[model samples]
Target chain A: MSSAEKPLIGHLVIVGVGLIGGSVSLALKKAGVVGHVTGVGRNRDNLELAQRIGIVDAWTHDVGEAVRDADVVLLAVPMSAYASVFAAMAKTLPEHAVVTDAGSTKQSTIIAANKFLPGPERFIAAHPIAGTEKSGAGAAFAELYEKRLCVITPVGDSSATALALVMQLWEKTGSRVVTMDAAEHDDFLASVSHLPHLAAFALVNAVRRQKSEGHDPFCFAAGGFRDFTRIASSSPEMWRDIALSNRDALLGQLDAFQQELNGMREALLADDADRLLKEFSAAREAREAWLAKHGDGL
Target chain B: MSSAEKPLIGHLVIVGVGLIGGSVSLALKKAGVVGHVTGVGRNRDNLELAQRIGIVDAWTHDVGEAVRDADVVLLAVPMSAYASVFAAMAKTLPEHAVVTDAGSTKQSTIIAANKFLPGPERFIAAHPIAGTEKSGAGAAFAELYEKRLCVITPVGDSSATALALVMQLWEKTGSRVVTMDAAEHDDFLASVSHLPHLAAFALVNAVRRQKSEGHDPFCFAAGGFRDFTRIASSSPEMWRDIALSNRDALLGQLDAFQQELNGMREALLADDADRLLKEFSAAREAREAWLAKHGDGL
Candidate 1:
């Protein structure tokens, strides 16, 4: 490989061989950015599938052994499992190893790293803002993160070397790296990602309850409802963990959204057509403008 | 044509030849179920385009002339213009003409028909539960209503002949016809269609408010948000009219949804992982099961 395409790390250990972890490995493998990738997970079938699909160079169940001599350790599991996973790696992580993560939330991940990682300065919390409703090793591909934004929220006192390594790792995978404060990242994501997911879940339950009253609407739920509730088919366990991990930010967003919803309800109740018209027109204009501006970025 | 494919009407007059109206004309014309289609609209350009595309055989700016010699009158204007359009057609409609509509809400249309039409029995209020986000004659297609549900709400003391003629018209266009009470149709549609639309609009405004405060969450919106807000980009004026016409039912739905949202907010505030998990998991399960059961129908 050319110097520009040289591997960034000697040995990399991925703690979860699922969608996010598997995709990261595949992207790095395609770019020749890692010397070797070890898949560490409890699911042997998933790990085997990842290795069979060429996402990892090998498979291992022992997280401690996998990170013993690794140059980079990536925690790619659910947020709820971060504490135990970090503790396991802390016991055997190499002295010079840099740590990173692909969790959706940042503040929780940083806290876990601070408590468990030997040198929390080596941990760079990252969230690659890209995924489908599907999960598991079977859903991974090298292009999953291509041209997607990967926000790297560097905790205070992070080592420059560790930050540079994490930044280069994502850039080589065709991701646009952006830096933001961990708290701000969590707050922003709570509105854009977490809140939307919860709203979809709530919508399905509301409609289902109505259906149980003998007025089934699913038969007429075509273009609009299908698209709107598509994410309601996402993994339940994953979403539950995300909701609990980012409780504060998610609750704040939910409150803001309730205020907006109440305003709409009041307009409808008071028969205020002008107010309803203004709200609907403004929303349509803003959404159309955003789509035009981010047509490619999205 | 075969006996089953026989023409259903002699001359069909379609007022407001936009997406719904234009599509009905095209579907009937392609099936050879109508002898001729006359398009009526304030926009001469749109009428001409509809005729040029063969959605209508001829065009007219005069509603009187269009319905004077017609055997069937299809009112496909926005809900807001129903009263005026109904009154205009009432003056010149042929005695034996079967009047029908393609409005979203039924109770309001039925009330308009009662007030404006000389013989309310001849006006069968109908709603074809199918459409794209697009509007205007240019976005119409011949198969837009194929296998779609068309709910016909027949007023008490209606003429059987007029109702039969209207049913035959939709059936000829490959639509599955079902009869429902006008009030019941309005209530069901409020939950499935109008409420979802309002929620989507409110969500966009809420996020936009945050963006104005310098934290733009839209930049991170992905597949879920795009699908959920796709309907937010629909015609604002049309939605405003629907919201007002079905004010009572829409308000009821808004209340129900608010209860659900408030429950979610409380769960998040209390950090009740179990409640959040239960809600998310139940929603995911129900949605997936619904999709499986209605896969082919949708």
Candidate 2:
């Protein structure tokens, strides 16, 4: 267990309690850090399920009312809904309440927070690099953030107390916390997460388009293709908002990836066996080294 | 156990005796389908290891010597070694022996066999669509082919007896067998297997090239990147040969993939959230459906 101090709070309100929000509630509740967890979501069934699973102490559809007494507020809604969610909560949120988010992109999230929330300095933007292809409150678990990396992107004028509280919250979830510039977080995640997802989606669509009269390519798709495109099965609605929210960074990542793909294509076209061998060898060595160091956690 | 009739062979000679070859030997030996298994490989240590592990009953360095009295011959060497292996075995191959292979690419293996062997009709080109990242005789197991798909590509004049024997052999290994034209097999595998492997390798290299000071993108790579690039850690040299051997089909796959990626890039650049959402939704639905049907096995 981590020796880091646990986040002490009376009421922790989680908006849009799906996998991320529900998981945060579960982890904090398990650590005995928070007195009570209030889950707010539009979906009644989902909220009921979260409460039934002990992921929340209470469930409600009223976001503003739920956070009236919250010491800390976690906005786990989709990026597309952040503006509306923030606008709804801004008017009723307690004056001293600290805010944080589990959004994948940090820059846009921070932007939304500044535009709607009165206490922008209290909003700490954090993205825990964790999750499976599975989503929803049903997929939430206390251990989802175990040994995961969490990046906190605090704005220039952000309150140190808010950032510290958010950092401690993630620490209680077993996440290693590191601070990064919001733009840097967006660019880094674009290359490692967003870009790979777009590639996987495109790869699957490519094969689907190539389906011939008598054959289904997917019938023969084995473990390699399955694992390689597993992310293609993630929430399309969630990913669409992400792709749009961090468009510029994602575009740069796509361009970088296109260059690599083009190089491999040219090597194959020219029948340059040596070049292909060298390229594949380098990738294999790098991936192996990373796996050796990380133990395949992600 | 399969209700299907088991393969019956006197002496089964498996060249290369690595994962694929050794697995076949193990599976057949467990089924009591072959009288004796003779392993052949350039590496003396590997051959001895296969024998010690009981994957093979005997070991030999000479392909011709091993196949002299064999009823079945499985060529499982790397694609680059096919021509040389075929040429060496052709001189002393028994007239009654049936030849088959576990090569990834069918057209090149068939071409090599036809060019070198007197009895091209006796060679049934096959690829059991199964494997792990692990390799060598030590990685071999009897259940490796259980419930996996095996594609057999027989030439127009391929001997019926040879094809039947090969089909029975795969069936006894617990594989679901399907026969297709060599060209069709190459194209199908190019879209499903080769293209995915290349994509994974390129994605890894793209991230590697973007490495900057104070940031290692891999440290933040989560489940999405891990599963999407798992195949990148596969055997590079073997994949290099597959890419080169099936160059034309793979190039076509690359072009198709490029088109899909370009479409995504356009959507992102245009800030077209609807198009991106539709694309991702379709991919997610398709992948989920495939998983539901195939159960994630190779």
Candidate 3:
């Protein structure tokens, strides 16, 4: 058995126990990595639910109270809410406490975190790949992190101890942890996350508009359409902030994809069935290989 | 109780017992919707499996042999394989038997089917909403169509008895079905299915090209990236046919989406965060509403 399989002992604090946060809270606590997880959220009902569920041994609305002497502090709130959250808790943070996040975008969070937190070195920005279509503390589950990736982004001025503690926490939750520079992480995520979001959003708009135009004649829609466009239903405020924050990188990614789409259009226009088939086959092979290799906690 | 909840009578003949066909076989047998289901397939192994699993009361390689005294004939092979299969069975088909399909593109299917089959009047084209990322007879399951929409396209001519029988079969299999024109169904499905496949393929190619250009980025791709690009792994030949068959419709859908994307780009270029957020919020709200009505099938 690995170290994670053994009983863990650490006091962890999680702020904003929504789907990702509450899930992490449950996963860490159940695995016994956390001695007593404490949840902090703006909603009193959420705090009560988190406590009743025992995702956290305790719950509170005060940031300072939540962070005091916490061995590890996790910010699971939206990116826009992080700066103020950090600002509220920085003063009372235990000097040795490791601060991290479960945010989607990292660079902006790191920059904002550095300005608000008492010690820039104490904060490490991390993005856990585990998520569901649901949200809130009620949506949180204990096994959310199993077999997923948790990317840790270390700022230039961040401390090694903070990074290691954050890594250790994710590992204990059964995650495969990796690290990258914050900017590089953001750039890559823009293509992977932001661009897909935009594509889904655009597709949804297209369908909605076409429906209005009364053009949908065949009605071949089924479960596939629903899944493909599901992300278009995500919190628009959160995604919009992400798009704006990662605008340049996402635009670059979309331009590159557009060129590919244009080529496909040309191929179709020319009735190049063979070429289109070949391209599709290549992508199919590439994608299946990747999915097979990454089967961790499916 | 609904008729679906009651036991089914009569023998149901399922042609081309591949994934959808096999599943229909299994579901009909399991739900007691039919006393017996006879399967026709080119693959000997599939026939064997069908017998072993009790999905079929009997099986045959010859299409004419299987359709002897049948109540319904369901074509479940790839779209491209339809012509040969239709020609093989059309002449020998039971005169009153209802003919339908589990095909993706409908308009062309109808046109080709009309020409090949003597009794186009007996044909109804259906597209089921239920499926997994998996395929083949081994992947068949009875519950696949439960609560899933089975979209039917009634083309130029129709036989009321045949249409009613086909609709009855779908209802017995637990499908909430809708009917639309073959041309319109093609248009809707292109936007919903074909275009998403193209987007996924293009997205994967964009990254592949970028990786070829310089950075070792694929190494850093996590679950979000994998899931977002999941559809890129679909059957290439299948997707290629879809693109080719629905080229005009896909192009129009793509154009509509591109215009919206360009609008978002203009907003970003002008640094109009307000407009971007507003658009994002609207999309999210609309999606959530749809999801609320449809359930979290995503």
TM-score of chain A of 2: 0.93
Query: Model 2: residues >4 Å from true position, as ranges?
Result: A1-7, A35-37, A48-59, A133-139, A296-298, B1-8, B52-58, B296-298
How well is each residue in A1-298 modelled by candidate 2, as lDDT tens digits? 2336544977899998898888998888888788888999989999899989998889888988898899999988889999998998988999889999899999999889999999999999999988765678999999999888999999899999888888999999989899999998999899999999898899899988878888788898988888898889888998999999999999999999999999998999899988998999899888888888886576
- What lDDT tens digits, residue by residue, belong to model 3 across residues B29-71? 6666676688888889978887887778788888877777877
**Evaluation by DockQ, superior candidate among 1 and 2:** 1
Candidate that scores best on DockQ: 1
Question: How many backbone clashes can be found in candidate 2?
Answer: 0
**In model 1, which runs have C-alpha deviations exceeding 4 angstroms?**
A2-6, A212-214, B1-7, B212-215
Best-to-worst ranking by DockQ: 1, 2, 3
- Model 2 chain A: weakest 10-residue lDDT segment is A1-10
Worst 10 residues of 2 chain B by lDDT: B1-10
Question: How well does candidate 2 score on lDDT at residue A109?
Answer: 91
Better candidate number, 1 or 3, judged by TM-score: 1
For model 2, state the Cα shift of residue B286 in Å. Answer: 1.5
DockQ (0 to 1) for model 3: 0.38
Candidate 3 lDDT tens digits, A142-191: 88888777888886777877777778889877888988777777777776
DockQ of predicted model 1 = 0.77
True contacts kept of each: 0.84, 0.91, 0.55
Better of 1 and 2 by lDDT: 2
Error of 1 at A101 (Å): 0.3
iRMS, candidate 1, in Å: value is 1.2
